[model samples]
Every structure is written in C-alpha cells, then in structure tokens.
Target: MINFYSFRDLTRHTLLLSFIFLLFLGEANAGVVVGSLTENFTCDGQIYQTFPTNGDTKLFEAKLDESGLVFTPRLSPNNESIEVQIKALLPGANSVSLTNSLAFNPIDNFLYTVVRANLNDGKGKRLIIFRIDRNNVVELAGIPENNGTIIDEAGANVSSSGLVAGAFSPINNLYYLTGVRKPVYVVDITDMSFKKFSAHNFNIADIAIDPVSLSLYASNKRNSSNQLVQIEFDDINNPTTIVRKGNAAPISSQVNDAVGASYFTPAGTYIGYQNKPGKIFSINLTTGRTTVLANGPNLVFNDGASCPFDFEVDLDNSTLTIVADDAIADGVDINTIQATLLDVNGNGSERKEVSFSATNGAIIGSCTTNFFGKCLVNVTNVKAGISVIGATVSDGTLTDTVSVTFIPGAGDPLKSLITANPTTLVADGSSTSTITVQVKDSNGNNVNNGGDTVNLTASSGTIAAVTDNNDGTYTAIYTSATTVGTATITGTLNSIVITDDASIILKNGAPDAGQSVISANPTTLVADGTSISTITVQVKDVNGK
Candidate 1:
C-alpha cells in the first residue's frame, strides 16, 4: 500500500531547504578569506600563461586574494612556441588593469611594454607603451620596433625629450621613452616639452632618482655576465656610471636562462632582488655589499622548471609575494607562493630560514642553519659612505659584502654666542670680569681645545689683565684713571667679528682735607677740602655715541 506524506512535514522540509540555500549565498557573498583566491587568469591569449596539458600552450590564470593587495600580476601572449614568463606586477588603475609593461607616465594614460619577461630587454618592441581607458582596459598605444631614432613614423616610443634613465621620473616631473637599442629620450612632463640632451648607447635595466641629491641611479646588466652596472646621472639626459665595473656583487648567476628583478626599499637604503629558487637578496646602496636574506626551496620538480619569475615587496605587510611557475605540461601547473616572513634583526642577519611549498601554498619546512656564516665578513669600526660590512656565514665557505652609508646630523655647531660677565666697568679702576663661551659640534659634543681663540681689544678702556681658561672660557680685568669719562671695549676672533662695543665709566678723584689752592688774579678762595662740597656726576655710555 502507498502512503502520502503529511502537509506539515512537507512544509518543514521546504523551509529547511530554503535555509540551506540562504546560508550558501551568504558564504559566496562574503569577502575573501586569508588564503582564498581573489583573482585568477581564465582564458587570455598570453604566452606567459601555462596550459597544464602542453608545455607550449601558454594559457594560465593569475590567482590573487585580498592578502595580495598591492601586487597586480598579469599574463601576456607571446608568438614564440616556448612558454612565456610574467616578471612583475606594477602599479595599475584598478583590478582589471593589465599591461604588457609597467611605467609611470606624467600624463594620465601613458603606455609601456613588458620587455624580457624575466631577462634583459632583448629586441624589437623591447620597449613598448600602452594606454589605459577609463574602464581600466589596457591597449597598445606605442610600439616602436625601430632600434634607433627618438621618434619614428608611427609615433611609437618617441619622446619630446632625448634619451634618459627610465620611462618615468616622478621626482623631476619627467618621463623617458627609449627604443630598446640606442638613444634614450627624456621629456619634461611639467612643461610638455622634450629635452635637447640624449643619452648614448647604454643598457639601462632599472632606474631610481634621488629627490634630495637630484641624482639618478640606473642599473645596467652586462651582456656577458649577470653582473649589474650602476650609473649616476646629474640629469637624466646625460648618464654616467660611477663604477665602470659596477658594484662588487653580481645580481644573478652566470648560468644560462637566468633572470633577476631589483627594487629600492622605500627608505632607499637598500635595494632588493628576487631570483630563481624563490630567494630574495638586498644590496646596501652605500657600501655596495649584497646579502641573501631569504632562500626558498629549490625547484626540483619538472627538471628545475619550477622557478620564481617575478616578485614584489609589500612593505606595509612585511611580506613578499612571488609569482612562481611549475612549468609542467598543463595550465593547472602554474601557481604562486607567499614567501615566509623573514626574521631580520635590523643587522641584515636572518634569525632563521623558512621554506614554503608552492604546490600546497603552505609552510613545508624550515631550518636554523646560518647560510651567510661563510659569506659574511666582519668590518668593524668603519666610517660611513662605502664602509664594508663583512660577515662570514657557513664558516666562511663563501664571502659577501654590505655597503653602509652614515648621514651626519643637522644644525650649527655652537649653541650660544660668547658673552662677558661685566660688559661695562671703569677703566684703570681695577674691575674683574669673565669672558665665557660654549663650543660644541653638531652632535652636541664639546669640542675641547679645537683651536678656538678670542682677542680682546679696548676702544677706550685699558685691559689690566687677560687670561684664557682653555675650556672655551676666558677672564679679563680692567683699571681706569681718575679722569671723569667713559671708555669702550671690544672683542674679536680670527677677523670673524665675535663681539664688539662694551662700555666702562670713570669717576672723579676723592676729596682731601686741609688743602688750599691759589686761583687767578681775583683772589678767589679755592680749597681742596674743609668746605663741605657735594658733586652730582651723570653716567655716560661711551659706546652709545
């Protein structure tokens, strides 16, 4: 016999189903979790994307979450059969903004191209520019494939100004555009005009401008070795490499097919780089020393095909997100890894080494081994500006150098002007005074016996005695005659005019008794004493005159 379900029971079941549906909707609408994917590549015609099924099919997605806020990575299409690599995620307008390259333009919608993927700028369109629409979509704006000339027929990478360091100069309100080959051009975006000066043949990789010093720093990668050459430019148009051979450390290994990326720390004290094996290293710009702070696990799968292509530092979070690729035959093989937070003790030394797995995107292993022990050399009691800080890590099997720059304090050295105790006194009347002065350096340290001198001169008064305490202090005594008048005194140092115009007052002589003086023909009674006499003398200031 068949039985029918009760109406109440059916109603209860329906309510339960509705409640479950609402719960699922809430979860879907909820913001991204800590490790949840916020963005991913779907199906874009980019060579940099991996196919998972075929090594040649560059078609993968870039996955991101809210945790990866500052970084915006993208995949570009390449005509070559080989797999393409995404090197960096530069600043963009919004989430959908993707470009072949990244550069800062003075104008709102300037263009740029991604040159060597993870290597150096190779050839045609090695330097390209793009424009972003209001919708945040990137389009090819300028693609100057020409190897020479500042402006081509197509108005590609041509700039109003001549050759410069990078495509952008935020400090000087300028922008540069180059043709990958020769002649770098610079333009003054403030005035919307091109500069007459142009930089000659020079391989510029990354550039940084010092706003305070008005100096430009250009990183040049050598054609033969992975070494980086540093060039300083007074103006972006005319570049000069301060070190011909470049800094002491090499940016990358000598192995073939290796690439590196570098950036200056926000503080500008250190420059950091990311290489294969998902490692991060920094060079002290002042000392020219390099130190490896974090080294991720070596890519052993896919015959070392698993490598880190590009990386960016989120100084706010103190975390580094590396775009890693496990170049297996399928698109699903492409992935990214968040490097373990390095425990640096301000000394540029690591407290421990931690490695995470890119496959699971989790912490895999860690060790307390000090890799820099052999490479670090101790440099003690060194002065600022190119002082070598050496460290020996791993028992000195390898060596490394660190450059340290020390900045001096600001303000004048002397705190107060020299002052005298009794600035005004009677001359030749036996008056004692103290001339005191305080000498110090910018650091507030007393500059004892720094060859300081003080000369006392009398404009009207006489100096009976003068003595130097030798501790930035002095004393002087004066004697005045019985003449009723005022005297002026002054002080000097090495003709620098330390102090001037001090005054002293002189009074009349004392009275005596039983003394008589003869006067002129009228026989006037002139007495030195006996007759009570009261005198009122007005004090006069000599220097006031």
Candidate 2:
C-alpha cells in the first residue's frame, strides 16, 4: 500500500509553494522623514503617502506614523516591502522598475494600482495595474497602452519612461494618466490584460479627474505656452475630439514652466496643481479660478507628486464620497485640512474681503473656523474678484502657507506671514534673544493686533516664554541651551507653520581638554605602492559638543 500517486501530489504542492515565494524578499521601512503631504489616501484601511525621496523619485507607500512629526513606511500583514510586492507580481518579466503610482479600486475584492515602470520586456513606459486580493496575493491585472513614443522633447530616443500623473475613475472604470511629450491616456480598468487604453493626444505634465463627472483635465504646454484642457470621457472607448489642440492658453505663456502636477480631492471640491516654483494651485472646477498654496522651495512633493494618496473607494456609494487621507500618531493628528470658503455670505455679492489666520500662527482675525474646515469671514466693504487671501499654519518645527483666492463674491482680505526679526540666534543660556512673528496678508498688509499669542519651541533649547505685544507681532524671549548646533525656532499659528534656525557656537568662555585624530587623505595605496596623508589638530571646550 505504498500510495505512489500521493507522492506526486506532495511534489506538486511543493512546487506551488516555491513558486509563491520565487521573489522572496522584504525590507523594513526604517528611519525616514515624512513631510506635510498635500494629500494622502487609504486603501483597505491602510494609509499611504507619496514623497519624492532619494532625489525626486516619486514613490507611494503604505506608511504609518507613531509620532505626528514623522512617518515610517510600514510593513504589511504579509511582510512585504512595496518594491518587493510590486516586483513579484510584474507580468512575464524577470526584472521590474517602477517610479510613480496611484491606487484604483472599483470592486471590493481588488486593489488596483497603476504603476509607471519598465518590466524589462522593452515595452515603453507601461502603466501596469497590479491587483491585490483579500489574501495579500498580487497579480498583474493589465497594462494600459502608452499613447505616445519613448521620445523626449529634443526629438531623440530617451531611456526614461516619462509617465508623470495618474487618476482612476469609478464612473467609466478607467484611469486618466499622462506622459511627457505624449497624450493623455484613458485606460479601462476592467479591460483584459495587455489591452490598450484609449489615448487623447493631449501632451501634458499632469492629470487629475473630477470625482463626480470622471472628466479629465490637463494643463498642456504647446509652443512654450500652457493651457488647461478638459476631456470628457463618457464613451471610454475612443475620443473624437483632441482635448488640448487649439485651446486658448489659460494664463500667460510665461506660466508654462510653472505647470507641475494635479489631483482632485476625494470630494472633488477642487482640482489642486503645483507650479514650477513649488506652489500648490487649486482651480475650482465650478468657478475655474486658481487658488495658490505656497510652500517651501524644494517642494519636490519636494521633487515628487503632490497628490500622494488615492485611498479606498466605495463602489457601492454613488457619490464616490469615499475615504480621505489623515495622518494620526497617538493623539495628535497632522492632517491637511482643506477648507472651501464657498459663497459664505449666501447673499451672493460679487465682492468680499477675506483674511486668514491660524491659532498656531498666533494671528487672529475677524474670520473664524466652522465645522467643515471653512472660514467664515466678514466680507463687508471688500472689493470683489480674486483678492489674495493668505493662510498659514505651523507645528513647532514645520511651517506651511496656503494661498487662496477670495473671489470678490466670497470673503475678506488675507493676513501676513511672520517675518523673523533676526532670522538667527546664538544659543548661550544667559544671553537672551527676542524673536517676533507677524501676520500679514498676501498684499503685505499687517493684521496683527499685538495681543496674538505666539508659542515658541526649539529642537536644541528651551523657549522660556512668548509675549503678545497687542499689535500684529508676537515676541518670544528665549535663553539658548548649552549646545553648539543650530536651534530651530518654530511659531505655530494654530496650524500655520513658520520656522527659523539659529546656529549655536561655543561662546569663547574658556578652552578645555580635547582630543584629535590624524588620518590619511588617500587611504588606498597608489600604483607606486605609496599614498599621501594629512593630519590636522583641533581643540574643544569642556563640553564635548
């Protein structure tokens, strides 16, 4: 009774297990700094954000935060890193490379993500959709066709897979993505594997969708000029009209270089985009006016896409009003609060003044916060049409500015950003330094009443106290710590983050015992079996730092 057939079954089972682990590898998401993401999304109850890490590599990952200040790329229940999970499921390819990606889910059982990468099969920039099932198993769902060539703007062949932006639609079961020097692609998610997505010859830098209409949009550049083009994709099979061709440029041609990326909020209240100088601009789909959110210089997301999260979708919900992204660590939530100052008056006047201030920014105004993150500003006596409204918020260490337009029929004027008096301070405990923060509008108008409260904190020292002068300025009189490094001073306007750094040097009180090490410059021997060396001596105060 040696059951010989049972042995065959056991061998087959072993092969299956080995095949499942063919790409057996995983890496822990170690120490990394996650910034104030413009937006983020959640899928299967897991949070994800995208940042241009490692020199502008647009990456999206399921990261988690235990501290509100930073986030660590998290490990899944299946013990897989993002790259390993993606590489294992690549279709018919030995090697895979992926850059930017966004998630799409039209069905409950499938998590579809469109990734930009070369699967080493010589197919240009492929928007490969990888589907993850309930068991955390992955498989390639399909590859959307790249409607353009692998050529750069210079007209020669290039190696880069210039896929830039992506958005998924539950309306047509499609994804709207863009590539450089190529057209906007409308890929059908429900299509068979290796099928082509319908392409609209709209060469644009980024693409976003109207969550309600599922319509596509792009700020396309032609002849060094940029125009915001709209695409209607009801058919999803083919397009009769070229969306970007012959369209009038939205702004001056000088704005061509300022075009960056785009994303629609879960509510689709507005479509947010970034300019070349790292500012986030929002175009109200209804009003078509631009609202700017000014950020740091390196805004790569700094170098990556600004819209990093595309969270879970409730296909069952008709409005597609699904989950939004939030970063919560312990009891603190460092979330991007997107508030829309709609026709706040309800009287529908075409002109109003809007002023913005955050509690953390210590800038208080006539405007106040409401339930929906909206600001109710007294628009009395304010001239209408695109008035500059400034919004700023900060934590102790990070500062952010949100640029908004008060469409004359809406709110009041803006407030100013806190300008540090000295911008730098020396940390030497007894020597006191005075730091002032002011609130101004976009027009450089001071709105501080001096009574505003400013809270100050330092990474390397203690901020004794902040005093309100009752003008628009708040001052913090601080004594530095005994350290010899830069101490960062952060002022929080409730949520607006304004910060400055001061380098601390050892105040030449007296010299103390120190040690020095000597080393050779070229440690490796040269061809003549000899090497050059250099030695330098240094001294330090009693404090090792």
Candidate 3:
C-alpha cells in the first residue's frame, strides 16, 4: 500500500536522505574545525605553530569557492580575504542555526554542535546537539535535558535552555556545556545520559580544557579586559563543588570577542577566535597574554573545536643548544650566552620567553627568544669552578643545559716582591739601578693577564714610570740621589694589601769635575819663587768633601 505524506514531512525526509547521502560520501581529513550559526563549518588547515600568520585566509577562500555559498554580512571580510567556507548546506535547507556551540569528541571521532531550530511556531526552541560525521555531514546526537523530552536523574526537566560554550574531555569521555553564570552540564556521549554540574560564579563566554592536566578554563570579560579563569572542581569527573580560581592576568586587546576556545595540546596553547574582528589567536596558559594568530572569515554565534593531534611538537626531534661566544673565565662578563631552540619541523619557532640560570655564576634571569628561536643572556661574576647553564622555556617543558669550566684570570692580590739590581749605589745623580716588582696570585701563579697594577716609589731617588712586563713582573729605573743616604724602593700590586720594599745604599761617588772646586793658599807666593813661601792647597767636591 502506498502512503501519502504532508509537504512538511516530505521535506524533512528529503533532507534526511540527502544528509545520509552526504555522510556516505565522507572523506577523511584532519584539522581544527570551527562552526558558525549558518551550519557551515571548516577545518583549519594552517599549521598550528604558524598561528600568527594570516595565510589561512586563502584556505577559507578556496573552500568558499567550492561550496558556492553566498557571503553574507557576518561572513564578509573587512580588508581581509574570505576566511571560511560553508561545508554543509544544512542551515537553510533544514531550517536550523548552529547558534549554541560546537565541540569535538576524539574518543568517538565525531564533531558535535548545538543548533537552534528556526521554526516560526517557537515550539522547537529546545537546543539540539548534532554530530558532524567524518564527511562533514550533520547528524542528530541528542536533545539536552532542557525542559523537553530529555530528563535528569530525578525524572524532571532541567529548565535551563541556553548553552553558549561547550568542550569535550577525552580523559573523562564527557561533553561539557554551559552559559554565562550557568551550571555546567556534563553528558556521556556513549549513552546520551546527562547531569547538571556544580554551579560557578564565573560569567564564562567560552570554555577550554587542558588535555594533559584535565584542568578546565574559561574566557571571561572582567574589568574591561578579556581574561582567562580556571574553573576548579572538587572532582572533574564527578564534581560536587565548582569554584573560580584565576583572574590574574588579562588576555590582550587582540581578542575582542571570545566566541570560542580550544586547547591545542601539542604547543600547550589555548586557541580562540573572536567574532568582531574575525581574529584567531592563542593564549599562553602560563601568562595571560594573547597573540593574534590570523585574520579569517568572521563568524556569528560561532564555536571552535580541535583534536589533540591537530598539531604536534615533536620534542624528540626538537633540539635546544646553549652556545657561548667565547671561553668562559672567572669574573669575566660573557655577553653572548645564547640558548637556541630549534627542530619544530626542522625550523626555528616564534619568539617565546626563556628563563636562564647558572650554578656558579650570575646570569640575566630571563630573555625572549628572537625570530630565529635564539635568546641571549649575560653571565658575570663566575667563580673558578665548573658551572652549569640552564635554559628553559617559560612552561618548563623544553630545556637545555651546558657546562662550562671557568679559569681563574687574576685572583686576589697575594704577594708582591721588590728587588734592586744594585743594593748599594754611588751618590752620583747619574747612577741608575733597576727596581723589579713581581706579582703573584694566591697559588703563586703569575698574574700574566695584567689584571693587577704595580707602582714604585723611592725614598731618596727619582723613579721612572713603572712598566708592566705582562709576566707578573714590573720594572722601573731608579736614579740615585746626590745626597748620600739610603733609598727605599716600594712596590705594590693592585693596591690591595700586597706591597714589597727594598733598600739601596747610595755611597759617595768619585768627585765629579763639574761639581768640584780646588783652592790654592800659596797662589800669591808662587810668583816669588825665591821668597820660599810655604804653599798649601785645599780640594773639595760640591758637597764639601
């Protein structure tokens, strides 16, 4: 017997059959998937690490060309190329809007989305959760317990209807949904059974969970800035008390609208999208700073979802090295201590903050890696010992270390010895002697680097400028004084408690003809040779010798 159905039923059956056919043609692909209100979703094809570039716009534009979907006001670009493509035509054909949110469950290998029915009777306002199959085709997942057919444990309707954000935790195998100041709803996708989670004070706009830690976080607008807050629970799997933990830092102005957020575990960053400026950005879980990744197609009532395998940081392949510009030495300043991070797909990563520490030296506490994934710090005041220099990324995930042995350049002033070539010298002003000053370290090693200074002074002679021989010895010329006396030669090294002295005796030299005078008492009597006058002569030097 042939049965005739109404027009509404015929249309519903046609769409259902069409959707099934689309699912049959499903092809496998992988990426971070984003959904919009128009039931259009696209998998982000850009590399996760290269998030700061706007090159992904071309991928979206290409998708639009294939789908032949009209670009509406919300999807239009503002000085940017088309950013996303409509993967399915279910929104207009099936009379539904994906306004609520979207989430991906890696365990089931399905992408789930929440959609609102666009019926004029307002009878189908209840939110419906649908799963996007591998071929980008939409299928009904389940109806949430929101005063509808679905019921809670008490067989009562959960009068809650609005859910703006959603996230799936592979650890617990539950999908979490919530709205601003609403109690979280946890659903077991295996059976579609759900429960209302503990209430929280945070007005969350979107939510993401760290896959490694199983810690849930929310993007919130607080005090004029978009910030990230930790939504803590007594037990995430079976929670009784939920509390808000963080308001520490604000995500920068780049993230204006927190439409959706997802955690890319490979790089340990929370990826989010803004609807206003159509900006894709990543938030550092450690610092609340936000970095604009790319400008893509704007989405209204949008949501983002990503699998853990979307991007990868092959730590085994990645490498880090500590490079020193020169040989390290004690008390020497090493201005070129660099830590280079490399090997993410065989290339340097973007600028990231790195921390430095040393075992037996002082170093700059932290530095940010440059475009080449290299960071520099200065090491100073190193002791004469083996030192280990450690460099770590801000998250403490990637680390590298190098050991350096510092040689003692010049130590404390230990000993200074002064010697005179001739300990005794004539009092003639022209006579000179050598004064040598030898400097040594605590271990009696010659301070060959000239790190120590030497000075010479004579008590009774004129000393010339000291000369550094660079072999731990210094020399100066000392001239003997005309006045016969002892000359004390003093030498100091570094002027820090190291001093030596030597004395030189200046004896009388042969009388200098230029400085001597001779007087003859019988000068007048010499003329009278016959007078037999007694003759006497007096000879003296300038000093009356």
Candidate 4:
C-alpha cells in the first residue's frame, strides 16, 4: 500500500514512532539518535539497503538524489544490531551537498548547517549558515547579518575556504567553529557575532559535550590516530583559554578513524561514527576504549547531535551503601568510613555529595564523591561506647548507616567501694567527716572510662557535696547530727551497675562536769537514822541529754 503524505506529516509520524520506541526502552536500552552528512549522495552504490542479520536493532540509513545528510541511531552494540535506509526529502529542494558542518541546537529545536552558496551577481561563493526545523523547514540562520567584519576567517572572504568542523555547546548557548590548525571562532547566536580564541591545541575534527559536567570531548588524530580528548575551559561563560586532557588508555583501532562523536546522556555513553567502514562504536570517557556496535552507510562529512537524555533518580530502586570496621581497638586504630551510591542498574553515579554523621564521636561532616561514586571520611575523638555512623545524599533521597563499638583502653568499670577517712564524728551536730569512693575494673585496677557516673548516699548524715576526682575516685563531705548513730555511706556506679557501702560513727562528745546539774527526789531526808527514807537523784550533761 502506497499512501503519499506531506513532508510535515511524515516527519511528525516518524518522530512519534521514535518517541514511543524510546519510552518502551528504559535507560539501559536507550540509544543516541544521530543525523549526519554522508560523503556522497549514494552510499556504497546502493540507493536503499537494510541489515537484517548481525545488524543493530536501531536503524542507520542513506539516500540517493538527496543532500549528504543521513540519520543513524546507535543502540546497545553488545546486545542488538540493525541497519536500514529510506527516502529523504526537503521542502522545494531535491538535491544538496552539506560538505562543511552540521550541528543541532537543542534550545532552539533547529538543525544548523554551514554551506557554500553563490550569489546572483556572480560575486564568487560565500559560506552561509542555515537552520532547519523538525517539519523539514529551512531558513538562513545568522541574524543581524554581519558585513564580513565580525567573521574575520580567511574562509569568510568569498575567495578562501572556511570552517572544517563545528559544534553547538548548550552550556553557554554558543556555536563553535574551527579550521585546520586555526583558532576556534565563537558564534553568539543571540548577537550573531563571531569572536576568535586560540583555546584548542589539537586539529579538531568534531566535538561533543556532556551537558551535566560541561565536559567538551573532541575526536582528533593528534597522536597519529583518532583519539578522544577532553577540553577544559577556564570559564564556560567567558572563556579565555582551554587545556586538553588525554585519556588514560589508547582508543581501539576499530574506531581509530572515527570523525563524528556524540554523548548519550541517559546512559552516560559516548558514541563515535567512522566513515571508512561505516561503523558505529562507543567511547569510554575516562579510558578512551572503543567497542564497535554495527556497520552501515559510509559518511565523510559526518557529525551527530542528540538531545541530552534526562535520567530520573529512582528513589526507591537506588541504594546507598556504607563500609567501616565493626569493632575498633582501644588505641592505634584507623577510623575511616566509606560510602557508595548506585543507581537502579547498580552503576556508580559520579560527582554526588554525601553527608556523614556520628552519635558518640567527631567526624567529617560531608564529602563529595568521585568517578566511582565513593567517598571517605575520618572519625576522631571517639568515646568508649557504641556509635552509629550515617551517610545520606545531599537531597536526602538515599541513606545508609552502620554501628561501631570502641573498646576502652583504660578498662571497664566493674566494682565500687565507699570509705570514710575519719570513720568517727562527734554528736555535736557541727562535726564533719571525709567520705571517699573508689571504682575498679575486673582486674582490680582503678579505671576511668571517662563516662562513669558515681552516686553517693548516706543513711544518717547529710552529704554536703560530691566531687568526681576524674581518676577512679570520688569525694564528699558528711555532716554529723546531734543524735548519736552510725551513718551507712553507699556508693553506686551507675554505668557498670556496681554498688558498695561503708559506715561512719557519730559518737557522744566529752561530758563537762562544771556544767552538770544534779537533782534529788526527797529534798528533806529524815534526819533520824531510824527513819530511813528512800532517796533518788538525776544528773545532766553539757548537751542536756
């Protein structure tokens, strides 16, 4: 069935279908949809072709009698492969050549292309930039047209060549262009002005950026083979210089000649396209390792761009893990704690900040994770007790906790004893005696755990105050009362649950004979010896008791 539809309808239909497919494919299966310029109108002498077997499930295609632009979607190379090509069209245009550069502006939802155009006055060809919308609509892009003053490149002159590569950086909303061994030309889309800066050192072929980190990646043959390098800007907003960061390992030979590169943000994957064999591969941002995914139409003037896929944090599926020793010795022990964060797929998320806390010790409050999604902090000045260490993300979305027990170097409090220096006190109510309590461990050695709570109590006398000697002993003043009795002094070690007691005697003071008074029951005793009357007498001391 052949149903002819307008280019707009076809574009909308294709976009809807692709969106639906992507919805079904979760983050793990998500891929980068790329549109680049092919070397020739016809790829490898085939007008239309498809890879049924040993092909990436995501399609790659080229067309005949059309512009050099071709669209390819790179899928999980290790899992599935497919290749296909279909007819392409443009409004009121049949054939065109995009030999210079292609970039997609995510903010404006327009594809920008720099192409050579000729004037009707026979003034030689001049480079003109054009923008295309999703509905296959194209228009001259650079606004407030410059009279060759803003753009000073030799190629800007209608007589010479111009840009060899281009990339659109969403970080600063600027378009970048460069030529062979030439300084980069910064194009401000807002003002349509070009500023030149010699920041890049390599002969850049194509550049891609990670919007999250603003890391600019370039594919260049600076060291004899095409390799991936990261370009760091002094300031993305107002950049004056740039430095190149090389990969830790060499790029695979399979992607040695890769000319086009793009980053798939959903999976944190970098993709590269090679024209020599029309193959696609993935590049490791740190190691520069490449894994070929599929083969398709050969493209020479190739460059790709895809929307930075936003990955939602799975709060329920993501996990936070903490690692530390369960038990720490009393002395000379390392107290380092570590935390790791992983997404739903169990892959580490880099550059995340996490906070740490402890219950009974001092610890580093926060730490930022590295490339491995891991961070470390130290716990110091811990006490002799169990402490819980907790780690949580900045947003408090994920959390993990662990417990550690610190052994006391001095020893644990076991038993307690109470004693009085002067075990006896006068009953005058003004006499006081010294009371002391000592604590010992299981080995009968005086020990201070720095957290011992010793309480003192007296059955008769009053304890004026108690003082912790800070060693293993405590002291208190026992005030005596007028009544003669024995004060049972009790000492309790609250932390270790041990108790002991000692007795203090309150004895009567010396009787004063001068103050003593005597009384007789019968004042007048019968004087007669024969009348022996009963006589009774009472005596009083100084206290009148």
For each candidate in the order shown, give its overall lDDT on alpha carbons: 0.33, 0.41, 0.55, 0.52
Q: Write the per-residue lDDT of candidate 2 for residues 290-404, one digit (tens) a residue.
A: 6453342333431122222233221122110101222211112222323233222111111122244432222224432221224443211122122222342221111223322
lDDT of 1 by residue, 1-545 (tens): 11122223333234324322322343322211001111222111111211212423222222212222122222333333112221112111122111212333323433222222111222222222333222223332322222112354445443222222344554343555432233444544332233433333445433444322334444354554444444344554343332132343455452112222233332232332232344444455555555555543222111100011112221222332333422221122222323222112211122223332212121123233222211111111111122322222222211222233322222122332445556544433455455444443344433344245555665444564546566544456655543557655565544345433456656543332323232344344459665443443333333211
Q: Which portions of model 1 show Cα errors greater than 4 Å?
A: 1-101, 105-128, 132-136, 139-165, 178-181, 188-204, 210-214, 223-225, 236-260, 269-280, 293-545
How would you encode candidate 3's per-residue C-alpha lDDT over 1-545 as one tens digit per residue?
A: 11112223334335444433333333212111112223333333222111112433211111111123232222223232112222232343344434444666666656666655532233334445666544343444544433122333444333334466787775565888776666677766554556676556666656776665566777786545577767766667666666556663577877656545444433456666666667666677776567775676565445556554432323444344546543435455463466665534343443566666778655546777543346677665444455677666644545446665554455444555788998898887868999987765544434555545777888988999988787667889999998888999876666664555889999876565666665655556546447554444344454544
Compared to the true structure, candidate 4 yields what TM-score? 0.40
Q: Number of the top candidate by lDDT?
A: 3
Clashing pairs in 4: 55-81, 55-82, 56-81, 56-82, 57-81, 57-82, 155-161
Better of 1 and 4 by TM-score: 4
What are the RMSD figures for all models against the true structure? 24.7, 32.9, 13.2, 15.3
Which residue ranges in model 2 land beyond 4 Å of their true spot?
1-51, 55-81, 88-95, 99-103, 106-112, 115-127, 131-139, 144-163, 181-185, 193-201, 221-226, 234-260, 266-270, 273-276, 294-372, 377-545
Error of 1 at 271 (Å): 4.0
- Residue 249 of candidate 2: its Cα lDDT? 24
Q: Which ten residues in a row have the lowest lDDT in candidate 2?
A: 26-35
Q: Give each model a TM-score.
A: 0.30, 0.40, 0.49, 0.40
Where does candidate 3 have its weakest 10-residue lDDT segment?
A: 57-66
Residue 97 lDDT (model 4): 29
Give the lowest summed-lDDT range of ten residues in model 1: 301-310
The better candidate by lDDT, 3 or 4, is 3
